[model samples]
Target: MMKNNISYIDKVRENILDHLKTYQHSETIYNASKYSIEAGGKGLRPLLLFTALEALDTDIEKGISAASAIEMIHTYSLIHDDLPAMDNDDLRRGKPTNHIVFGEAAAILAGDNLLNESFNVIAKDKNLSAEVRIKLVETISNRSGQSGMISGQMLDIEAENRKTSLEELESIHAYKTGALIKAPVLSACIIAQAAPEISERLEKFSEVIGVLFQIKDDILDLEGNPELTGKNTGSDAKKGKVTYISELGLNGAKEALAKKVSEANSILNSLDELISTAGLRKIVQMFAERDQ
Candidate 1:
């Protein structure tokens, strides 16, 4: 199942890249956007989107545009996050960041271009109905906009250099990291036209995994290999940013991760009678045990 999931992820990455190539008429903007989009991070958002569709017994191809759009937004966030005004990181996915390779101005434009183009891609998708497209746009916008990821980012920046309570840290990440993560899964639910009961269960599952993803990331930042993670470990600590590991201690954080993982699996188990949850179960394990 893991190998199959990897195969699906590869297919999704290729589809997104092919879709992105349609905007290659420009020189600098196109190159900068392509560079970051093609960077070597795992296409987790798209994969989750596809996997959710599979779990719902929907054709994964039905979600191609949405998956691409979400990835573009995610890549845009990373590009802006690495800028001097933000995290100021020099490396991303084991290579020079967009700003480092393309200069700050071009990189900023590249991020902007991706953000704008993401909406266009969804709005113009001919495969989905007008109503579905509109819902997709609305969902992505709400999740990635101020009410979701961006608000979380602001909270994170504010909390830096200070001790944050566990509740505060979770709330911050529930937006920063968890929002985008939830976007893909929720997008999948929308695409599948999942029944209300099933959608509610999956939403709950997404929420658990969203927090689980962050907890695992916090653990990785402290103990992961830079070669595999494609960025500096311990950089969070160096930046004096609060994290799950900081608030809960290393073992405490791991315990929280285990609890979330179990919760996620239980949610999936509940859905087993309604849908084939094999793929989602694999995703839970991947989130819990990924090295990077």
Candidate 2:
């Protein structure tokens, strides 16, 4: 079931890639644009969007556009994050990072393009209702901008060389990593015009999963095999980057993650609407038990 769910997501992502490639060109902007989009990841954000939409019985065509938009925003973030001034990661998804393939300036421009183009993609999707389209734009902007992911990133960069309290770390992760993670799930509810109570519960579920996801990522960095993980392990410790693992220690981090997983599961189990969304349940389990 889990493997099937993953394959379904991959199919959607492949379709998204194929559609986006239709807009390709021979210019430098085109080259840099393709670099980031083609640099692959697990496409978890898009999967979350689709799963949440399925859980809510949202209009599938609209859900897919939103998912593609979210993926673009996510990919753009990764492109900028791998730049020289940021994480300085040379490799991503088993390929050279965007800045390594494209020059720093081009990579930066590419990131900007993807970020702006996400909205265009959403806007051009005629299947979405006008109201849902506006809400999605607002949700994406809020989650990815000053009040969310961007602010979280600033906190992360600053905390890298300093000691941080757990409270401070939580605030940072909630914004930087958790904002984007939570947005797709919650956005589905909003786009579907779900009940306020249901939407809020979905957000809460997303929060728990988001934090747990980051915690698991920290664990993978410490203990994962690099070949399967597709990125450098131990980069956080090697760079003295502060993370939940660093602040809470391995055992403490595991305990915290377990609590989060339990909380998320409780929410999922209670949502009668989600019982049929077997893919969503499998995703939660995958997050909890994944070694990388």
Candidate 3:
């Protein structure tokens, strides 16, 4: 189930990459854009959008547009995240980070380009109604902007080396991580014209899974092999960042992860009408159980 789920996700990512390649040009700006996009990751946000849209059996074309847009935004975030002022890591997904390949200025512009130009892809898509396009614009803007991932990053920077309550921690992550994570799922439902009740249930699933995603990430930081996780593992401890594992202890974080997995699976079970996508459910379960 896990292997097939990963293959399905890879196919979705390849489709998104094909769409992205259409926008590619020979310009240096285009080269920088390609660099970051090609940098490998799981493409989780876009996969979530695809899965949610499939669950509704909606317009597949519009769903592809939404998924591709989310990937652009996510790649933009990664480009900026590796800049000198941010994490300053020289490696990402087993390649030299974006800023290292492109000069710092080009890297910055590449990220900026991806962030701003993603809207054009959605707006120009013929499949979506104007109202859906507008709603997607609003949601993606909010999710990627000041009150969402950006704000969470700012809070993360401010709270570093300072004591933060568990509530404060969740607030930061909910915005920084959860906002983008939830956006793809919610945006897909909107594009699919799914009922409000179904959207809310999926949003709940996104919330819990997003939190556990980061929790497992923290655990992997402490215990994962660098080869498997594709990044240095000890940096979190070296940076003195407060993570679920750091705050709650390793065993405690594991217990919390188990509870989240159980709840998330329960939600999936409630949506059993789309039981054919059980591979996605199994993928979520693997996310909960992975060591790296």
Best by lDDT: 1
Tens digit of per-residue lDDT, candidate 1, span 71-151? 889999999999999999998999999999999999999999989889888887899999999999999999999999999
User: In model 1, what is the error at residue 136, expressed in angstroms?
Assistant: 0.7
- Which pairs clash inside model 2? none
Instruction: Report the error of model 3 at residue 63, Å.
Output: 1.4
Q: Write the per-residue lDDT of candidate 2 for residues 10-129, one digit (tens) a residue.
A: 655665566556675646867777766666678788778777777787644457777777888888898899898999999887788888887899899888877887887778778878
Q: Rate the local accuracy (lDDT) of all candidates.
A: 0.89, 0.81, 0.78
The local distance difference test score of model 1 is 0.89
TM-score of each: 0.96, 0.92, 0.90
Kindly give the number of clashing pairs for every candidate. Answer: 0, 0, 0
Assess candidate 3 and give its lDDT: 0.78
RMSD of each: 1.4, 2.1, 2.5
* Ten contiguous residues with the weakest lDDT in model 1: 1-10
Off by over 4 Å in 2: 1-8, 11-26, 273-277
lDDT per residue (tens digit) for residues 1-292 in model 3 = 3343245555555654565567766477778887777776877776677666666776444676666677888888988988889878787776788889988999999888888778877887788889999999898888889979999888887877878888888898888888998898889878987778777888898888888888898888889887777678877777667788777899988898888888888888887774345745865876777754
